[model samples]
Target: MPHPASAAPTSRFPAWLLICGSLMAIAPLSIDMYLPSFPTLAGDLGVDIGQVQLTLGAFLVGLALGQAFYGPFSDRFGRKPPLYVGLCLYVLAAMGCALARNVESLMLWRFLQALGGCAGMVMARAVIRDRLEAHESARAFSSLMLVMGVAPILAPIIGGAVLTVSGWRAIFWVLSGAGLLILLLVHLRMEESLDRRHAAPLRLGTVARSYAELLRDREFLGYSLSAGFGSAGMFAYISGSPFVLIELHGIAPSHYGFVFGANALGLITMSQLNARLVRGRSLDQVLGATLLAALAAGMVLAVAALAGMAVLPVLLGGFFVFIGALGCVSPNASALALAHQGHRAGTASALMGTLQFSLGTLGGAAVSVWRDGSALPLGVVMAACGAGAVLMRHYGRSGARARPGAR
Candidate 1:
């Protein structure tokens, strides 16, 4: 089992973990880079809070749709074509976002930009699988998570600083620069990982049938949904947390990045910690523990909010715990879902990416619906997603226990 980022055919641990990790970081970089600028964009563009929120939703829609194209195309062609194409598109899209004069324009460009970004995000996972084994994929995922962790931690801090000097538009410029760096890095370090020796000539009919088979696989569906809904909880928080923290609680807009980054700290720290636990226990065994912990954290937030105990520390600690638990839970769940789908890994990865981002959009929508200028609304959304994931994992594991396993 070779690490996908590893260039050598027989090498399991790629020497360029830093490089592969950075390529994977592009999507998160596109996202967290602008979070600190959300409020500023609303004011500069003369848009309502809801309209500004569409920027986030648009990125997600693009990300969802972008994967459908990149996945099969990558499967048919090779990895680098999509990577190069997507990075170029991301730069163009980021520039468009920088130039947007109105909410509608920003939303459209943001979605279109995600169309490029979704390629980087989805292919990173496929590449890791292309290079590694079940447990090794989890390890590579941890590396990827660590890289993603830096974007959330550093992007907003950079955004906040840039805002003081140049305003929100500067953030897009920075994203464009980041995308350019990724483009160069991929050329220098990444080699093609996919072997199309047995790959079917990728066609519309075959691709449709491939997707159909994936949709009907109960075990794959179970694990994918379990990881996906769990991730939706975090996206709900991402969509609404800034509003709750800055506007409602009176935390300064400049400080929102730190609060957001604090949650990433929780997620990053736990994900790396979970990596250490993988050798001693199976991924499922570890997820059973972590998802329950997240469920408990969400429940506490819900109960505490009901008791009029909705305070800053409670909000911070609860999210820190829930998202941290998700860091451990999600990568493992995704790894498990694709574990046995070795032949159609590209198609399988696409559907999981599709479902994951789809849930993310729906979760963002849920936040908008209950968005009543308070932490309680967001807390309830998180609680429901966390509880839903727990239920899915519970029954999904049992259902598989009684059946023949994946080929």
Candidate 2:
């Protein structure tokens, strides 16, 4: 209908949307795709399930550290180069993961893979900031969520199928292939989203100042922490779900996949709903309402667990509502935070992601340490994160109102 060359920005929107969504999908794929392989991987590597699970922690650690590194680098160089390098590293690390001889080696390779994969996560947000105003960016993020959401929904199914026929090693090989294909798409279709004039030089002092500026902005920290703490509950759910569903409730692995997909669908549905709601509403107002909703859901969850009423059905309903709240919180927070940080979008995006992953790691670790083969620990951690988000949002808004000549 439109000339292809002129269509790059809008008319051929689906092409770029797919690319950006794929970029965001990289981290989720890396995390969820190998989950079904945990048992087989432990057996093959001569380690127990707990040891195999450490690879997840290692990957998350890498994701936190690597996002911090690439955000500044992307700000200095153009977005495209950092992404290219990160994807290349991802491919290499995935190959190493496939060839690993032991749990320790696999952990190292997984960390490297995460380090590389996080570039996509950070840059995807930055690219959205680069192209759109705050409100538009929120909608773009929800659309991206729709595309990226499919990865978590399908990755386990795909991984389970591969593990069924070709074994766990084949799973790594498949990830490697996916990385290579994404790299090719980037080279062929994606243009530089960051304008050269806005590029800051990569110096230690400059980088420190950039981050320092972000930390000093009260609104930015509020939105970032609100989003981070809101999303942390889902990470706790992910870390605890396998045990709760499969081991405790005795759901079969095949059926667990379906249950997992169902919860993820809740998340996806809420995110798109957020996109629609925001069209006629302010991001701040929508965020406030969603944070409160998530808090209520978390309260119900914790009360159920504390009272020993955490049957599988109850737990599933709580997860559906809680994660759906995050779908609203995340896009709004990112858009609001970056609204004022347009000049330093990469650094802001990076810091936001770093906080999110760090908080998630804390929630996940709490489940491991406090796990008593009951749902209490998971429920408590989830509730805490939600409460923290609500408090942050309240403080942020109050502080904004107190500022002289504030909008």
Candidate 3:
């Protein structure tokens, strides 16, 4: 089917938003939902906590690699076909995770699950680019962030409850059910979003040229890198928080879910506030301001870590602001990056996801390497990511220059 007009039909906007938001939520849901189960999962698999952590890193790697293929494939085919295939793979992988007896098998299945599930994240951004203008897309992304926030807010809580009733393996069973539900929703409600006239070829040379073209756009690179590093900080927190809060700080497992959910709620609240604040303001202005806030929060977090200060309150408050700052940065940076790449929205979005997840994997790994069962690794890594984002936007001269032939 040919793509619809630039904006989807008014009557369909709610459904469109729901579908895109839910799809985008898939990754966070998968990641956060099982987090509360980590201790129990490790015990059941007869592995150390560090080995369990590796599974998360492996999932990030799979997500990073998978987007490279799915983005270009979606551009060649249509959105719905690749989405269907990905969701099917997700269901199978999730079920495999539920059945796995060892950490090795569990890690492999989780990686495969990410490979299947990340199609939603890549395509959700591409769909936003395909359907909206730059500023409008930023606003839409904020709304999608609000919707996506529900998953993280509820996921750990739900995972905890399920673990209480059953076991860690049941978490994967629940995720498989989620995949099935999403597949049915796509089949019933989602129309093809890719326009036939803009279809990219499937050849390797064409794919290389497309990414090469995007790389040459300094404006795109600045925004993409800033967003990528900001995401790295968030992933660092994701990788380290369970150990820091529960294992080291002595927070109970059930309460850990609430603490995690509270941070997610803060992020959701900030995204909505950002959507309103950016109205009539330039997205660049919003992005610059938020990066500064993130940088300052990072500094405070680092000091608290290094000085051996009030650990829990410092982490909670610092991250409340730090992650909230991301609420502003991510959508605006994404909008700015893809503003000039309408014809290759999928490729551009794919590259953006690749950068974010690849950097995120590294940040998470760094935390593991420096793990001392304290909040120091989490604080230091997150601080570095925030500082890195600020530097990229400042020295990178965001939006000051563009590629010669850029849109």
Query: Which candidate achieves the best lDDT against the true structure?
Result: 3
Question: How well does candidate 3 match the true structure in TM-score terms?
Answer: 0.96
Please state every model's RMSD to the true fold in angstroms: 2.5, 3.1, 1.9
Cα lDDT of model 2 by residue, 1-407, tens digit: 11211122363246766789999999889888888787788899999776777788788888888899989898888778889999999999999999999999999999999999999999889888877788888888888888898988898778888888999999899999999999999899887777777778899999999888777777888888888888678778877777787778887665666777887788899889998999899888999999988888888889998898999889889888898888888889888878777788788889988988888777777776677888888888988999999888876676566656877
Total clashing residue pairs per candidate? 2, 0, 0
The local distance difference test score of each candidate is 0.80, 0.84, 0.86
Write candidate 1's Cα lDDT for 1-407 as tens digits.
22343333344335455666776677667777777777888889887777787788888888777787888887878777888899899999999999988999999889978988778877777777777677877877876688778988887788888988999888898888888888898888877777767455688999999888887776677778888888788888888887878887888877888888888888899889888999899888898899898888888888887788989889888989998998888788888878777677767888888888888888887886776666777888788888888787766676466557632
Q: What does candidate 3's lDDT look like per residue over 158-236, in tens digits?
A: 9999999998889999999999999999899887888887788999999999899787777777788899899999999
Comparing 1 and 2 on lDDT, the stronger one: 2
Question: Which pairs clash inside model 3?
Answer: none
Error of 2 at 274 (Å): 0.9
User: Model 3 segments beyond 4 Å from truth?
Assistant: 1-5, 8-13, 395-407
Q: What is the lDDT of residue 3 in candidate 2?
A: 20
Model 2, position 314: C-alpha lDDT score? 91
Candidate 2: give its CA RMSD in angstroms: 3.1
